[model samples]
Target: MDFSDTIGVSAAGMNAQSTRLRIAAENLANKDTTATTHGGDPYRRKTVTFKEELNRQTGVSSVKVKEIGQDQTPFEQRYDPAHPAADAKGYVKMPNVNSMVEIMDTHEAQHSYEANLNTMQITRSMLTRTINLMK
Candidate 1:
């Protein structure tokens, strides 16, 4: 692949990682959200799925977000009798989001984004050097 193609692929990767970061942030933001009604489901953790997409013209495969699906993991129950959404047994269903997991996901996504950005920058620099050499 050429320098442009390398940059394009890196950009696509960055975009996918950006989406992942956003979803992780969203999950973290809603980590404490509880169900409005008793016995109702609270905010489920969001997950990001990536798929390989091919650019027909460039014959390049890049990553794309397949879906932002909800995690099917069961919510944890907490004893919060005074809470408004507490059930009859004084148990409240908490969100499935785990803060530690979300933080880890965020860090991973950030690293992936930085990697792609670095690839793009290096490719750009190489292209620039090639042009300067020809002058």
Candidate 2:
């Protein structure tokens, strides 16, 4: 495989991780959000699924986002009688997003992004050195 293929693969990985990080951030931001109306569903945690794609021109395989789906976990019930979103039982349905889980996922995504960036940088350096040696 060519050095350019490595770069392309790493770039694709970075893009996928970037999307995952974005979704994680969104989940974290909406963690405390409750439904606007009583007995309504609250925010559901979003998840990103990745799929592999083949580049016919370069014959290199890369990753892409397959879908952004909602988490199937049940919402948490929080006692907030004064809140407008609370049901008759004085319980509000909180978002299923868990802060610790989101934080860990964000960290993992960051590590993956950094690794892909490092791969791209190393590939570029190798290409540069090759050109310099040829010159």
Give one clash count per candidate, in the order shown.
0, 0
Candidate 1 lDDT over 1-135, as tens digits, reads 899899989999999999999999999999989988877888899999999999999899999999999999999999999888899999999999989999999999999999999999999999999999999
Model 2 TM-score on a 0 to 1 scale: 0.95
Model 1: pairs clashing at backbone N, Cα or C within 3 Å: none
In the range 1-135, model 2's lDDT, one tens digit per residue, is 899799889999999999999999999999988889878888999999999999898888999999999999899999999988999989999999999999999999999999999999999999999999999
Which numbered prediction scores highest in lDDT against the true structure? 2
List residue ranges in candidate 1 displaced over 4 A. Answer: none
Measured against the true structure, the TM-scores of the candidates, in listed sequence, are 0.96, 0.95
Lowest-lDDT window of 10 residues in candidate 2?
32-41
Q: What is the C-alpha RMSD of each candidate to the true structure, in Å?
A: 0.9, 1.0
The TM-score leader among the candidates is 1
lDDT of each: 0.93, 0.94
